[model samples]
Target: MLANMGNEIYRKIEQVKLLPLYTATDLTYLDRLEDILVKNNVRFIEVTFRSDLAIEAIKKLSQSNELIVGAGTVRTQKEAKDAIENGAKFVVSPAVVPEVIEYCIEQDVPVFPGTATPGDIQRAMEYGIKVVKFFPADIYGGLKAINALSGPFYDVKFLPTGGINEENFMEYVQNDHIVAVGGSFIISESLIKKDDGETADKALKSLIDKINLQK
Candidate 1:
């Protein structure tokens, strides 16, 4: 039953196509970020657990049902619990941790743990994970790596993140095996630091325009 619930959440992400992986030290940027996402027709955002304010950010953003907010960079079981309590609809980890995955399973929340090698992917599969995050995708050979895994892991889907930008994003998302492409390209830390909505809007609109044209 929990596994079925996870798949339901995964389908929602697959429909969106783009998953903006954001990390901000300041909580002030989340609202503005949501505005930019909504304007560009994006429905989901992952607030990374890299900062001390990640939980607060997720809580604040989850108040609105219009946005699908999640917690990223989750490492420990405790973090997973905390994220869910704060209203994270899903949880993502940089690497697969059996304990953390188990915690998410018990809570019945979806999880996308990072997997690099075949061994990592295999281990995640044993944990009933059907989808995973391909971290550092550019250096990990991008589509080449995903293609390689597709042969053996035919039932699995991937969300490639890291080093992904508008210039080469379609290459990853266009593939059937990839559920979505995640990166900070559309909302980079530097852009958030500037706090200039006009500049950010232009960049986001350009990306969205390209995406629509591709479709």
Candidate 2:
């Protein structure tokens, strides 16, 4: 519950609005993602532990001083601990978990717990967190939904994911409350499957350029 935390995340978002999230195992593929992030000066990376090699991947990426690495799909307090222990500076989960929330707070690690409805948000607010993830963002009405929340939850900040993309990226990043977005565009399945390091580099840089241009 980082309710008191300001739009520092939005500043973080501005720095890394266009990011690549490697959500699965495949240490082999991350080499491409890392190369793109480095070559293009992309600012963030989410190395999700949805696979067997996540801890190893986090260790691998930790060597890079430029990347702000986070752990996505974090569910339990144990996973959160593992993420932080291994090198994740932040953690994000697709759903609200009270214990995990408390763990992050005590550990001083930023956690973006997901919420979709007003009730869900209220539940999150009870914990005193200001920043929350708008999970399945497109399914939850996307920007329109976020706009609706602004009236009642003006102080809240969001890191919209799930359906956020390059074509619709600006619509989210440009919003006053949106901190950033997490997606596969900068490192999509097709790109990874092909091991297209060059394409990934171009895409990551192009996305950064696009977002910065809008700013």
Candidate 3:
């Protein structure tokens, strides 16, 4: 049952192809963000645990049947437990935390832990995880690094996050090794903080259009 659930979520992630990494500082803008995502037909969102309101944001957004809400920047089992209890359908961490990964797998929630080096990917592979996040992708050699890593770990897939933007995100997304590209480029911090729904909507639509055009 748990493996089936994981496969289901993985299909959704692949279909979306773009995972919006969101950080909610103020609770008021979540509705606006959700509205924009739904309007643009975006089905997956990773609400990072970067703010005090993150748990509440996850709870509120996950209530919507239209979205698959996940928790990001999670670094511990306690945080993972909190996110799941509040309705996060998946869990993402900045680094591979054994406890968190073990906990998520035990609960049957999909977990995408961050990886930067071969050692990190090797560790994650030991847990039977195929898809992992290539964090700070830009600083860590971007697609070049992923290409290198893929040589040894041929079956591993990546969700490249950090430093991904409108200019280079497609480059990562186009790679077969990447499951989906994630970052704050589309739904930026400024846009969310200012509650600029129009800009946010346009950005998301534009990217979605680009992705569609690529196909």
Candidate 4:
């Protein structure tokens, strides 16, 4: 089982407690953005499949050994396969899709499927999934939901995404149950359009500084 091979996803998150969720419809700024992420010491990043350029970008970024690239918003088996075949180190979904989870497991790829309710968590457990994404976290009650799930699902870990920003991110990370937090507010798409990366670089550095200070 891939589970026995060791959970690389958790290992990466433990090393650096932040996962920047990025989506770029424009491929022009990908290289510069990757540089900014690396400069801030971000070892793991999710290049979401929100655009056509996402696959190509993942392929380009994964060529670098310095960064562990993952595909986010993967909703289908084909998308999962494409991402993994193109060198995505992991896969993430906004909701649970049993087939997608099964395919990833079969391929020995780590996947963080989204779980919003007790039923979702239970189903994921059935699939032998160790980690999941508590998506749209803020709107679904944030830390409270995570705490509630801890009682019965203590072994399961979470990567909370959606509505996470600088202010509340530290709060989420403080919880040991939360493996990582995914946010795109600081690495705004508009900033990427600037091309020079000065704005994105500054924002990333500040966020990384805060994470280091808390540690």
Clashes of each: 0, 1, 0, 0
TM per candidate comes to: 0.94, 0.90, 0.96, 0.94
| Candidate 3 per-residue C-alpha lDDT over 1-215 given as tens digits, one digit per residue, 9 for 90 to 100 | 44466788888788889998888877788888888898988888899989888899999998867799999999989999999999999999999999999999899999998999999999988888888999989899999999999999999999998888998888987889998999888685568565468878887999999999998
Angstrom error at residue 148, model 1: 0.7
Q: Can you write out model 4's per-residue Cα lDDT over 70-126, one digit (the tens) per residue?
A: 999999999999999999988899899988898989888888899899998898888
Residues 16-45, model 2: lDDT tens digits: 766467865566676666666777767578
How far is 75's C-alpha from truth in model 1 (Å)?
A: 0.5
Predicted structure with the largest TM-score when compared to the true one: 3
The residue pairs that clash in candidate 3, if any, are: none
Model 2 residue runs over 4 Å out of place are 1-10, 193-195
> Which stretches of model 3 miss by more than 4 angstroms?
1-4, 193-195
Q: Clashes in model 4: which pairs?
A: none
Q: Report the Cα lDDT for candidate 1.
A: 0.86
The candidate maximizing lDDT is 3
Which should have the higher TM-score, number 1 or number 3? 3
Q: Cα lDDT of model 2 overall?
A: 0.77
Ranking by TM-score: 3, 4, 1, 2
- lDDT of each residue in 1-215, candidate 1, tens digit only: 55799877788778778888788787777778888888887888898888888889889989987688899999999889988999899989999888889999888889899998899999999988889999979889899999999999999999999888889988877899999989888675568567556787788788777767777
